[model samples]
Target: MQSQWGIMHGTHTTPVGRVRDGALDLLKWLALLSMVLDHLRYVGLSLDGLYVPGRLAFPWFCLAIAANLHRTRNAVVTGHWRYLGWLLLFSVISEVPYRMFIDDADTLNVLPTLALGLLVARGWQQKALIDRGLALIALILGAVFSSQLMFGFFGVLLPLAMLLVFRRPWYFSVLPGWVCVAANQWQILLNSGSVVALTGLVACLIAPLAGLMLLQYAKNVSPPAMRRWAYALYPLHFLLLLLLRKALA
Candidate 1:
């Protein structure tokens, strides 16, 4: 059977079967909300504690990418280019607000890391020369921008790792979990007093498997509306947070 996007579903199961899992959508929004809360700590409050909740964002996003990959299995390889294009566009658009909101933040921002992650995942999925080239570019950019973000080069690699172990047994995800933890410098930090940090570290380790399992079991979700205003949400939310912070300050 085929869904509205003309992609096959309920047939030819991959590691995870084809389905429109609502839980994945729920996870994405939850992750997005958690990320916003984490950013709010920098903008309005010193709730460094909120960082734990924020940890959900990246992994959930990675899972979303995996879900998209499963859904678009039939699309031409070029279909992924459009997805990367949207991510790149958002990354550029969100740069100013991201920098403005987070003190001492590098301008490249999270979207670039995600874009690179997509390239790596697609390259691994399709094994194309262009995809491999794009992944290389992402890696180079991550290296160049490493000083700005704590996660740096490892962040770019996290999604690919997630894709690699996707849908395997829970224990199998540990390899990527270790990589995710290392990517975020989990062991190096000594935030012993901060439950947020500890929780975030643990979540980072488990998010891939959790996300994969969720997508594997659930179904009946709709894609987000693609109105132009929808894309503005990324930057606009930051502006709103900035304004809220200023008012409270």
Candidate 2:
């Protein structure tokens, strides 16, 4: 009999030894769709329900980061600078559009949180002086100015936590999810948050676990590839949404 954990090994095989995980790709597409729906709420849609699904977007993205790190562990030896560089560049590129698209977005866009999280994840893996130093500095900056960060320090730490528990059981996500809840303003939301807010909050907590389940369970589903072009979609979506908002307004 085949093992139950067969999905972890992936479905599609390549001669080059790299297996393309259709489930992972599907999760990415779902994440993208959720993000778009969340952003649409701001584009003059009275779709408050979108917020619930939107909550899944960030955590799923973080899980993707952790998954990518696990898949490309080899990059640790060969400098992950290119990965950092791309994120950093897009962080800069996305800022203006993010500010323009979102109302009063005083915080820096989400990419910085992700970039720092990547560094933190890497540090967790190797704990090298350089990796730890960079992660430390980024963490300090995010902590000192948490308000100016999209997800704040704890949000930046989430991906690293996810990375640490990448291969662990799905329930392990709850451990790091507390940090996620706190980073997402749990104190304020917990008391007065409505049904939607509370549901979204719960979704935020479980998104990683859910995403991991999708990766390890959903088999034989091929979603489109989300490659370098997908990075451009971040800023492009902001622009497109801003245009739509202008039209709707």
Task: Using lDDT, give the best candidate's number.
Answer: 2
Model 2 over residues 43-141: C-alpha lDDT tens digits? 987999898898888777887887776766654355367778889999999999998899877789899998988888877776579988888887887
Cα deviation at 91, candidate 1, in Å, is 1.2
Candidate of highest TM-score: 2
Each prediction's number of clashing residue pairs: 0, 0
The global Cα lDDT (0 to 1) of model 2 is: 0.79
CA lDDT of 79 in candidate 2?
38
Candidate 2 stretches with Cα past 4 Å from truth are 1-18
lDDT of 1 by residue, 63-131 (tens): 677667766665555667777888889988989988788767744677777887777777677766886
Worst 10 residues of 2 by lDDT: 8-17
lDDT of 2 at 35: 92
Taking all chains together, each candidate's TM-score versus the true structure is: 0.82, 0.89
